[model samples]
Target: MEKRNKILNIEQIHTYYGVSHVIQGLSMYIEEQETVSILGRNGVGKTTTLRSIMGLTPPQSGTINIDGIDTSRWQPHKISKIGVAYVPAERHIFPGLTVEENLKLAARPGNGKDAWTFERVCDHFPVLAERTNQDGATLSGGEQQMLAISRALISNPRIIIMDEPSQGLSPLLVQMITDVVLKFCIKSGITMLIVEQNYRMALKVATRHYLMDTKGEIVKVASTRELVDDPEIIQSHLSV
Candidate 1:
């Protein structure tokens, strides 16, 4: 059997916000080209997990290895330089910039190979091509989400971390975003760690699922097939 490369590894990370303790000794790993979803109720440190990995909120004690290099103490910009892209839930595109401009600003030849060009990203998201001149603030929520994902892709990241990609969208738009993500995963073969409250949509894109409890601990990790067949697991961990 061929060995799978571990692209991202988080082990025993403890993060805190001021005096409030969160993300108590959380550990997880994502293999290359794999899509893993972290599911939990709101405020279970789902967002914090991503933030910790990105160095936005550094963990006080833990090791984050990216491609076998320890990066727990690396700054967020340094992390990005190593081919890690983060798309937060807020979809923080430059509101005043044109859609094309936003993508241009984020374009980079990551790792000095397999760089994503403007044309390629536009091909991946044709809607973005049509709205090239539109201001980032003018696009609809779904469009803004696309732009955000596109901005990340333009960086040619090895792994993409997303927070609630499907939040606040209509069912049709959700399905559309899912399709885009699935296609991107299939084509690019880039690893992803997504934190989502939309269980159905997350399940659709992720091959593996990690269930987090209220205390920010990952209580279970299972294949998507297993989790989909077991609603009790979802109910026990995710239901209000």
Candidate 2:
């Protein structure tokens, strides 16, 4: 299939955490209706790259284009209004609120008038519906991650940037999360950029992949088949 139009265009983002340069010239793009994965070891600028695109950690220099509009200068909320959603690695949920409440806060329109509803999100994760009244703090790591994603879906974004969606989950739950992401890309035609350390899970869900080295630089970009078949690239850049 010919690739869809680019939904996100992140070009040469240079970001810093105080005096430390974290992300150096990182560039990547997410095409509409496609699934892309950002693979790297810890502290390889994966999180920083997501943050830069989200405007939480603004880049000193870069161009962030969402559906063709350059939004590098926009604030986080403004960028979000342009149809981009971000789910951080930390799983930011309102600990005091119930799962239902969290989703309500994140709710927005999707492509047209047919946006995501609370029932639809619960249907995606039936377990969430079962625990609708449960407090966020009480949910398991995997459940929290589910809520994080459901929250993003409520926004009906064109492209969702996920930072470590599989972090700290049991193997079973990791599979669940991966399944949901793939379903979204296939069924809903939602574009996504996921940052994950679990190579196998990432490969299964991603159409294309990009690897960031320890220096916060993009080292490799390939199709999922190329990524998984070529073990040398993983050994060279991501071996622990």
Candidate 3:
């Protein structure tokens, strides 16, 4: 088999919030076009891991490389400019702007070959298209989540970092988000690093899973199929 290039690499990263030590020597890598997930209970630094990668909270030590460039110290906008898009748990859309405006404002010009155009994003997310003129604050939670993802896609990112994409939604909406990831992202060859509390939804979209311990260390890394078959592993690491 051919070896795939590493699109994102995190080596021995330690992050802190003021005096609170969060991530402790965490290291992981995602190969090109692979959808990898970090799964753990609440407050396990899964979101911190994504934030560290995107330079939202730069690791005090260690290194992060994106597309062969060292981005450990880069600012958030600089990181985004280099083809990394982040969808946070907050769903931070501009409440005053229409859905179409939100997507348009996030778009960046892509290389002609694989560019994700406004029309293309709307096509993939038809609900966003239907609500083009609606203000972001007026949309339902699921619609807001869809808009968030659509905004990320509009930026034409090579990799997308999603933190808890399935949180606080109906089961039907969770399934819809899963389908969007599988059908639109996976098929489009977009590399995704997802931090999810919903293990079932994460398993449905990701090929590999990394389970984090309470101290913010990776305790287990396994193929999704292997982990799925071993209820003991899931129970031991992820169960409440």
Candidate 4:
């Protein structure tokens, strides 16, 4: 049997927002080329888990390892240097800048021939190519989401972490975004750790799912087959 390479690992993380306890002893991991999703009702520390992994909100305890190196004490930029990229839910593009400017601003030269070059990413997202001169904030919600995701890919990360890629989009747009992510997982083999409210979309793209409860801990873990075979799991934990 082939060995699995862990791209990201979290063990017993506890994070807090000004003494308000959250992310109590949450632990999870993603292997290389794996796509994992964390699902739950709102305000259940899903985003906080992603934040903890990225070093945005450092865990008060436990360890975070990326590519086998402990990064619990690293800064967000330092984490990015070690091949972790993030596409936050807010779609934080510079409103005053053009699409081209935004991509260039976040660009870190990737590896080798198949690396995600400016032309390559633009080719992957022709809508962005056509609107290169347009200010980021002026674009429609779907377009902005595309730009946000493109920014992450252009960095050519070992793993990409996304928070609510489907939030605030229409059903049609949500499906479109889902298709984009599915393609990334199939073609690029990019590892992903996603926190999403749209479990249907998440399940479609993720090979594994984590069911987080109100207490900020993982109560259940399932493979796509396991969860699909047992709809009751979704209904019991994920349903509102």
Candidate 5:
């Protein structure tokens, strides 16, 4: 494979919540069109890492670079505007609004011919197209996840960072989401960073995996093939 340009970079990032340090000198990078995942059991600061990148929680120390620009102190909206999108596990779609309305609110027009338009996203997520007229809160958990992902795509972001996308779904829905995300990585060429407690789903979706320790640090970084070759890392790091 040819080398791709870097899109997101984190160097020794140390983030905090009221003086309680969560991310401890962590660093990583995502290249253009790469699918990267951070894997850990619950409460290992996986969400905080995404928050730090999104500027919802800025790092007190270290630097965050997005597309060669320093965004360590930038606000969340500004970070979002500059080609980064986040899909929180909470799936905060507007409950009272129709699915189409939720999508239109977040859409950003692009001059490129291949920009992710509403119709194109609908083609990818037919279930959301079916629920276009339905209220966001009225859809099943799986449909809402698809909507959240579609909304991000409609924005035409350079990279999409998802936090625990499989959190509240059943096994069937998890598999469905897994398939959707896998398709996105394989076909869309959209860069992705997934923070997942579901290591199985992450293993199937991400090309590279950052395994986190209980101390809120990356204990090991493994390629998907490496982890698959040695499944015991899952039992050691990701098992409950």
Candidate 6:
């Protein structure tokens, strides 16, 4: 298959968390309409990498480019407005708000044809429509995850950075999440950069994969087929 246009490109980024250096010269790239997965064990700066892209954790050095624009100097909202959406694993929805309200709150103002509406999100996640009036807190873990993804989709982003989308869930829920991601990539044509520990699930949806070592460095990158066919690469870096 032909490669899509480059959507997000990170070059040698370095970050810190209160004097502790993290994300040392980490770089990655995602093409348009492609699903790219970042795989690594826990505490390896995978979340930090996503934070850096969202400008939540500003990098000390290096550049972040989204659709050829220099977003390294942009704020989180600015980056978001430029079509970069983030779905953090924490599921940042309002617990007090209803499901519909949570979706509405994320709706962008002055967005054009590509912007997502409540109906569109409901179409993708029929359960959200069924629970439109339910309080966000009452939803199950899977529902919360769906809401988080819907909230991001409501922004109509050109690219979405997802962190641990399948964490803390039942196997069935994980499969559902995986199916949703694949549908988004294959059907909706949405570009994505996902951080996941479930290598098998991730490989099922991703076209390419990157590996981050415990030291916050990119140790390897390859196609999904290569990563699956060669288990040694995973065992070497991802093994406990």
- What TM-score, computed on C-alpha atoms, does each candidate reach? 0.96, 0.94, 0.97, 0.97, 0.95, 0.94
Candidate 6, residue 102: how far the Cα is off, in Å:
0.5
Q: Candidate 6 lDDT, tens digit per residue, 31-130?
A: 8888899999989999999999999998999998888887887789988888788999988879889999999988864366555788878877888999
Error of 2 at 120 (Å): 1.5
Tens digits of per-residue lDDT, candidate 4, 1-240, equal 677998888899999999888899898888889899999989999888888888899999999988889999889999988888889999898999999999988888877877786798788888899999999999999999999988888888889899999999999999989988887544687899888888889889999999999989999999989988998999999777
Query: Candidate 1 — which residues are off by over 4 angstroms?
Result: 110-114
Per-residue C-alpha lDDT of model 2 across residues 144-222, encoded as one tens digit per residue: 9889988988898888888888888889999989888877544677788889899888888888999889889898898
Candidate 5 residues 186-205, lDDT tens each? 46788999998888898889
Candidate 1 TM-score, true structure as reference = 0.96
Q: In candidate 6, which residue pairs clash?
A: none
What tens digits encode model 3's per-residue C-alpha lDDT throughout 63-174? 9989888899999999998889999999998989999899999999877766877898887788888989999889998999888988888898899999999999999999
How does candidate 6 fare on TM-score? 0.94
Instruction: Rank candidates, lDDT, best first.
Output: 1, 3, 5, 4, 6, 2
Error of 6 at 195 (Å): 0.2
Model 4's alpha-carbon lDDT is 0.89
lDDT, candidate 4, at 145: 94
Clash list (residue pairs), candidate 2: none
Worst 10 residues of 1 by lDDT: 108-117
183, model 6: CA deviation in Å?
1.4
Candidate lDDT scores, in order, read 0.90, 0.85, 0.90, 0.89, 0.89, 0.87
